[model samples]
Target: MLAFFIYGCDSNNKIWEVFQEKDLLKHPYASRCGDCHQDIYNQWKNSRHAKAYISEDYKKATHNYSKTKCLNCHIPLELSKGEKPQIRNFHKEDGVNCVSCHFSSQTNSMHGPYDVFSPPHPSTKDEDFRKAFICSSCHQETYKQWKKAKVEKTCQQCHMTPVEKKDLIQKFPFHWFHLAKEVYNHEFKTGKIKDLKVKVKKEGNTLLLTITNNQIPHNFPTADNGKPKVYVFVETFKNDKKIEEDNALITPKFAFIYNKPKILEFNFFEDFDKVKVVIYRKLSWQKKKEKITEKIFNFK
Candidate 1:
């Protein structure tokens, strides 16, 4: 429902300051996690999660919400230490630290404390701890949806597969790469042509423009809502005189078609050798307080 991430880093600075206090450091879980899941720990060290607090998006979103309450989830490690008492210092780049869910005391587990001091790191003898709960604690809604759909399989089931996961998990230099990789080409680049051509010509008082959807896998704007419109304008000035001005707007029929190429046609009469055309797919967002112009073509 929320527009995802959109806030500033007011809480981040406070989080680190609060974390430094003696009361907060009473619970030490990060060092324990580093001992067991050393490989995953090392991999996650450079991962996006490791820098969740520092992310510009997370910083902004947390600032807009109630600082005290939101900082608890935003900086779970400081909450487990019980130093600041209430949510305050959550704006630090280390927003979500390793101690968030990993701790030694069993009392800190679950929704209340949101702490787990002693989790089964890979170096620890127990390998069974690498189960779904590790991911479910944060992705509760998604986990619920998967459970209801009876597709709550192992992470490897989907993440390390043939059809969907082939490109991402292949052999590479490092055991794991934080950035996502793919075997198949992206949707936008799937069927794109090597060379694309567009030209316009003049015939007496009229102009002709041609556009080719050469290498596009689908269409120019191959999206859910395909309603596209084109506006053409022509103006002629001769001997310091505004001789004539004409404009035409056209809307395509396949507005709702899922995926397909679209060929448009337009013709207008004016004494000028140049004209302007614009195309729009949808309405602009009200929050975007600016005039947006899309001139498809201009010929002389």
Candidate 2:
């Protein structure tokens, strides 16, 4: 799971000294990395990881940043080698930055999925960087669901799939010349509707709808806060007139218990000539429900 990259250092080696500073906040911002890693930094700047602290949705959910508990993951000191992290006061606005994942206090060095000669700053190769456990501290519920599913793909494999890139870093005097390597995408796209296996059926007076997280390793609509929801809308029409409509909302708390098939049942009248079922999901921070899938049934 580990990947390697060469690092070139200047004779003075001022970067290593800064990395050893007690105040990690003093560490360079992601923008600074852009000087050398323009593409990667731009990708990170537009990601949720970059907006973890300053996002309006997060602010609303935490009641204007009053909840100290909610702030921990958004501004963690450093992710523990095992799980969880200690909160830090500095660099609150930076959210989950590069150093948060790369810097290791134990070894006092930058840790990544690489073991290369990085004399600019001490770098360690950590296989955990490529595993899902590294994300478990903040994504506790999703990690539990993934473990239950027993999927082979790690979080990084799915969310941070690798892409071929020629320039991993900008041209620097002492930097090693790298051809092309598979660098992980920092977009972190999750909660895709296409990943779910959904089926709807009519049995007697009950409309049974089944949903399975076929592709996603974690629970559907998973979140630590902001109240994500899954809506199941059912409607019956008689002679082109709407007869009955029923809907159900599945929240994060209940979605976590979705180890088994999420079968939603709705009782309906037999007179209906047609029935329609629609499923939609809204992220905790989203304002509108995005359609996942829908079905229509006709009765003779």
Candidate 3:
């Protein structure tokens, strides 16, 4: 029966194992993958993916899952390239778990970045896992934003940061079977605040501030469902006493897209000793805006 099932699949999508539909369904929990992939699984535990469905912020944002569209990415059955995964009917607590990204129902196997020889569950080589398109389904807007930037770097290049010469699995016997290769972090990464660059110019009492997203490759404070904000605070001082204070907010709608320059002009209309510019950011899930960077420009 399994042999017939294996032969029934598309030639290009065939995996090694002859697995029935139920065979793949047997292992339903994310923790099951941790038995062998201890390190990788541990990293995933600290990731936002782990908190996707259970996040209090997510629940509140979705109005307690009243929005059905939001559930697809949170507890996905299987994520496909170029399309959002279907919502799973069971184990919703797993929340974007291992099988959500790796398992393929079509072939009844785990699809990963590299081919594996395993006696446990079926795994096959899939280069699509190495590309940014795999992330496009859920990060639709950010994926579009990245495509506009026209950079060669994939989402994994920055988010699932690569470290060379590491074994993919850590379990004793599994480690003995697998060879060391380039390993990427399961805990997706975010850009550093220091990577943001600001240039200030003065023309009489007017200040021209050019903020460049030199490193962050996606929209600044980007969000799909929730509103994130970027704030630019401008303060002018005379004799060390503050004279004027102003702020500009960049919402997700009016964002500083990746590698783009956003310009702000502050017309003071009068002389001041110095000006201070501080930028703060609040991500979609954050409770408060955190300081990104600050700079002081002297007009003395």
Q: Cα-based RMSD of the predictions, in order?
A: 16.5, 4.6, 5.6
- Candidate 1 Cα outliers beyond 4 Å, as residue runs: 1-38, 64-66, 78-92, 107-128, 156-300
| lDDT for each residue of candidate 2 in 64-130, tens digit (9 for 90 to 100) | 9999988778888888755667886877788988887778777877787865544345668898988
Top candidate (lDDT): 3
Writing each residue's lDDT as its tens digit, candidate 1 over 16-79 gives 3432333223444443334433443554565544554555545565574445554544455533
Please give the TM-score that candidate 1 achieves against the real structure.
Answer: 0.33
Would you estimate the TM-scores of all the predictions?
Answer: 0.33, 0.84, 0.87
The lDDT values for all models are: 0.37, 0.74, 0.81
Best by TM-score: 3
Candidate 1 vs candidate 3, lDDT winner: 3
Q: Using TM-score as the measure, what is the rank order of every candidate, best first?
A: 3, 2, 1
Clashes of 3: 0
The lDDT of model 1 is 0.37
Model 2 ranges off by over 4 Å = 1-26, 174-176, 239-241, 256-259
